[model samples]
Target: MPPVTLKDVAQHAGVSHQTVSNVLNGHPHIRPTTKERVLASIAALDYYPNQAAKALREARTTTVCCVFYGHNPEDISDPYRNLVQSAFIAEAQAHGYSITTAFVNDDADLTQLRQRFLQREFGGAVIVGTVLTPSQVHTFQAWEMPVVLFDHALPSTTNVTADYPEGMAALVQHHVLQGRRRLALIIPEQDLGSTSIRRREGFLQTCARAGVEGAVYDGTWSYDAGYRAMQALWAGESRPDAVLGGNDRIGAGALRAAHDLGLRVPEDVSISGFDDFEFAQFTTPSLTTVHIPHGDMARQAVRGLISLIDGTESESRVFPLSLVVRESA
Candidate 1:
């Protein structure tokens, strides 16, 4: 079938296309009964406004840049990152906008990207993942361009982030409530971003409140990191009764390491993770993890940036994470 248009709706309603437009745009001159008829016709025809033509007439550029500050192009393959990227793309396209992706590997690359952004190369930008340095972040703060920051917390900026503290606290509470007093947390060796920092803060505070013993181990954002963190923790004279990973990737690694060391999950030790990635549910005993709303966050980030570009106010939004209980914990 052909695409439904304003004219089609107008014809079905037995009115001019301009009348349909007037009704759709909330023009007050139209009668209530007439508006009802036009709306009914619209519903029947399933007509949608042509955003592409509207943007063209308004002289609005439909291109936005999604910059990954501290990640390599290869990093986009990670499940969390992949989900966010795909979601943003779909949402932007739905709004008749396009996304251009750029990767900033280091400080030098970040500086150069800033220069391009200053030239008005994009209608707006969504900063995803992480940043390389404090100065690089400062550059984003001082820029005149409309931008949305994701996963990072900064005053006076539009941000979209998950409730990391609450998620981490729930994980800690789950383990401690099950009578696991001694715990270990495995996190990325790279500079802990705002999300990681918040998670750590929650873990520490919750452990203190519950009178549980917990320790942090540094590792990468990968399976090896979880594996190595567990190995290092076991190298000591004692072992934790439970282990929590920063993300599912690390959690899966911890599970592997534990099995390799002849330990049983939730029997010898309980293990849980953040970001309930697909693999989390498929582990030997199904890992318990935190479920972050990645798709929703991506949509919000895109909408916020578009709002900024349209000279509208968009406030920062923090979404809550849910705990997924499973046999691993």
Candidate 2:
């Protein structure tokens, strides 16, 4: 069958195409009875609005693009990425908007991505998990497109981020309350950006207040990195009684390392991580970590982007983080 169009609904409702368009666009000029008739015809025919044509008529794209750097097949396979992306997709669909995803790799030129935005005419953009270099951020600013950043922060751009500092602080205080004195933190390399830095600051501040010396091991944000960091901690002159993994993946690795080293979790050394990924619960000892609420963050990002697209004003909002206590800690 041919694609259903406004003409079909108009003919079925015995009204002009303009009248059908008016009703669909919520124009007040259309009579109540005519509106009902047109709506009934639309339902009977299973007519759907042509989003592309609607956008063209309105002079807006009505589509949004989500860009992530360092995200690939491997990254998407991770539970954390799936959670965040699923939330974003559901939220975007609720607003009658479409989402397109793009990946930026180390050797790939960003100009290609920029060209895509121009070709597709995306109404707005949301960038997730990408650390924007200063120059790159300047380029985005110059584009003057409505943009929102998630899971990271950038200068002069609207962003929705988890309360990393407070989350880490709560994790640290929890261990201290559990009577664990010496604390160690396994963090990703410094250049990964503000999220890690804020988490580290929170950990350090909480440890200082408790009068405990905090040791920090800098490494990548991966299971292998977490395993190596734990090994190095054990080899050190003094071992921390508790360890904080930057995220759930790191925390899971730390738990495995503890088991391999003949250390009983919470008995020999307690471990906690951030971002309660799905695997956190299935670990040998369930992970005690901070839950960043990916769904809420995605909802907020969508709300903010809708406001931006609709020319509405919005204030910057930060979602609160909660500590999930489980067996590992």
Candidate 3:
């Protein structure tokens, strides 16, 4: 079927397209009955305004796409993503641009995304929160529009990311200060993505310099995986004295697993996590974590992506990470 246009909406509402536009623009002169008719027609037609023209006739209203990715639908709904998204939207609107959000979970979803982008009215897109696998990188390279990868670094693309290794170094040294001689990192399986590699590099390098043992454990980025990894580590004869969770969710799970095993945190094993998620402070012991400045990241990334869209080059940005020490570790 052909794409629905403003004319379709006007026809469905039995009004002129000008009347539909007036109602959409909130002209205030239109009667309540006319506005309701237009809205109902829009819903019935499944009509989406040309995003660049959505509710604004001004030339400043550039529509930018924000694409979020995850391993699954649930992961896409993660709080971390929400943090970034809220910030991203606010920052975009600050510069007079309209924002639309999209999700890409796996390669299969790429087809739908491609269809939208092919006919898209947007100028540029900001792809954030996704693990940039090689295939993903390759696929993104094919896109003709400007894109900025947020929190995930891609040598082939402009990136606005965090200093993960630096963050991990701070975390590791904190553990070492408490006389922790052995450390282990529980994170998602290794990938070429900057988050995974930089985190490991920081943990291992810091541990080696501190003359402490640091091991890496692989798992899904989920609470269940963290729980199982912790259980397996405890089952071993020589488990690390300090456990570092890749993110707060994993750390929360590890904390629970330790409690269930009748082990006292910090007494048996000290734990730390990343991403100072809201739940971090509310955890039983209150999780110690590294804070990713989601707002700052969003601000920087949106500015950078928009710059690139305006025929200017934007260098990648890396924001420093901070550690929030709490009772957890």
Candidate 4:
């Protein structure tokens, strides 16, 4: 992309191109009235006088920041975040750029990230596998660089995400049709970002529409977390006949929890999940799940970010989700 040229100021100022330059450089003895015309022209174009602005256009724009939020240091190893990031890295490498992992765990980390990137060392960023509170969102927006969000959406930003509501609705409808009136869901104790919230809301809405009793359990995005939630949900005498996991990993954990509690699969309680991960079909009874195309989303995010970095047109896109039925459900 080319920077605005002297022709821009000349178009309105009707002065020699050097006249605008003289005005900007604070040349002495220029008519104050004439200088104001060039100044006004610069302001109208929203041109930045800082060298950073110029360096931005001159920079190679070949590096991409890969940012993911971690609640704790251990969350840096989150499988879901890793898989999604790996996909982005692969695509970014294919596009002749390197991906730099940015682990953001707290406000201090976030502030440092924003400052470091403001140096324009990275062309843009792809933020995935995290929740952004309103303040966090503002921090990211302050980067003043192209960005693509995965599994989340924000105004004025490009986003690539699977249609969570569609997938959750399919899962809910499938369970309700099986005569499972008492359904329960296990989701991250946190909002888990827009995608997770969308799934939760979709389940609730679909359940209400189906006139079935639906309950939700707070759990993290792991099999162990799912296991604990299942244990707690089933401990009560009034148990749900069907349960949904936030993801396949959680579903697998829930399956084990049922077995440990002397319960049968499907026969005792139907189990299903989102993110039909590769091992879903290999689970005990196989796991029924919503297949979110994370790979496709990552590819789209990379493409969109590249387009923005190159000063081309890029629009946000939403991918549809599909439900995969297996024995577990």
Candidate 5:
């Protein structure tokens, strides 16, 4: 059968095509009874609006784009990205919108980036984990499209982020309570400029208050970074009794390094991680890490974007993080 059209609904409801259009667009001029009759006809015919047709009529696209900029595209493969993106997808679908993804390597051309978004006819954008250059952000602002930013600081654009400081403090407090006198923190060097920086601040402040000596190691937020940082710690004359990683991947790497060096977890040394990824449980000893609620953060980000699209103002939101205790710590 041919696709159902507004004309069919108009004919069935005994109204003009314009009346059906008004009802669909929420023109607020149609009679209540007339609106009901038109809606019933639409349902009876199982009419679904063609998005292309609606876009043509409204002169606006119904799609949003998300651009992620970073040193390595693989960084998003972390569990944090997985959870946030998953939530964003589900929430966008619920709001009758779709998302497009783009990547920008460091120092890419702004004009080229704009062309990509234009080619896709993106109605708006959500940038995740990318530190937008001031000019890039200005470009998006100039386009006058709704934009939401995540993980990076942007003036003028709305943002959603995790409470890294509080989460880090909790992790350190846990270690202190466990009687860990010498503590160390391992973080990706890249993260020193972002959320990881906040985590470090929390850790150090807590350590000072608790009077525990603390050290920091700069590395990648990966298993390799964690392993290397741990190795470096072992080689040092004064080793920390406890180590905290920036995220779960780093934590896992630290665990491997400890195992290889004949240090039993929690018995010989204590280790912990953040972002309770899927692999956190299966490690030799289950990981005690901070659970960054990615799903919840994603949901909030999408909701904020939807509100923006609908011309509703949403307050800046922060999601809470929790500590998941297991054998490693």
Candidate 6:
């Protein structure tokens, strides 16, 4: 039997040989429709690139790492994290790359990660879930290994993040337009990532500009946290006219707390949240929140890393955040 070649795949896909080559090399300029046709044709024809010849030409691995901080595989449950990881895996696979997931939480793990990086076991890496310190990021930059920082920004690394500050500002403006003063925020307990910082800054700055009194309650990124924070906020001398949750989980928790306290949401007090998680709409009276494009972010991050690995310059991008209006707010 004859081995399938790039020419065979190109003929099968009805594209030029160079197009097939571009697809195999993960060229960023190819149209998605054309790329899809080429990929499908390759799979249909069971065409596999000549590994040795390819290595002789590029001499680089096709394995990319998705590095997460503060959590291991068995304990991972955040919806956003799960979505982005899945997207990254799919996108990497589409680009003829394999993805390996790793967890780094402390100095020991960081040391191990650096060692693996120095060994050139990964072609590139995507930093997700937690923001690394500036020095740590600089170390990666010094290694000349392509690194994409998701949801965070470092001076020397490629960063991809949603416009969280803009979303927060818009949400606050919406609350003000609704005639809701005395705004309150339910912030997550830990500054888990850069998203938290952006949201906090956006809320504070927007509230100040709007001349709306605001209060903040620290909590975790969970329903229980939202509930507890809401309880604390309401137990004060006066309750907030409008409450903004850090995320849907916290918002859902806050909604339950409000219901338990006999307060009517959007009537007694309006409530809003972020992330637009799956359950955001199902909660009683639903939830109004910001929608972050998880899939898009993941795709861009993977592509950016791939471009970097190919010795092509990849620029940082910030995805615009959009508000999803529902019943809660």
**TM-scores for every candidate against the unseen true structure:** 0.78, 0.78, 0.77, 0.79, 0.77, 0.79
lDDT of 2 by residue, 60-154 (tens): 67688777766775565577677877787888889898887767664223444554454455767777764677677666556556677887776
List per-prediction Cα lDDT, in the order shown: 0.82, 0.79, 0.81, 0.81, 0.78, 0.84
- Comparing 2 with 5 on TM-score, the higher-scoring candidate is 2
Error of 3 at 94 (Å): 1.7
Q: What is the C-alpha RMSD of each candidate to the true structure, in Å?
A: 16.7, 13.9, 8.7, 11.2, 14.3, 14.1
Model 3 global lDDT (CA atoms, 0 to 1): 0.81
Cα lDDT tens digits, model 4, 245-322, are: 988888999999998999989999999988988888998889999998888889889989999889897888989999
Alpha carbon lDDT of residue 83, candidate 3?
Answer: 89
Error of 1 at 305 (Å): 0.5
Q: Report clash pairs, candidate 5.
A: none
The residue-by-residue lDDT of candidate 5 on 193-250, one tens digit each, is 5576788888889899999998888987789999999999999999999999888999
Candidate 1 Cα outliers beyond 4 Å, as residue runs: 1-59, 111-120, 132-138, 141-143
Q: Model 5 has how many clashing residue pairs?
A: 0
lDDT per residue as tens, model 6, 1-329: 77678799899999999998887665889997887788778767756566444353345888899998666567566787788999999999999999988888765455546545544567779988555788877766765668999988767678998989999999999999999989989986468568888899899999999999977788877789899988888899987899999999899989999999999989999999899878888999899999988899999999999999999999999999999999988
Winner on lDDT between 4 and 6 is: 6
Q: Largest lDDT belongs to which candidate?
A: 6
- Candidate 3 residue-wise lDDT at 313: 92
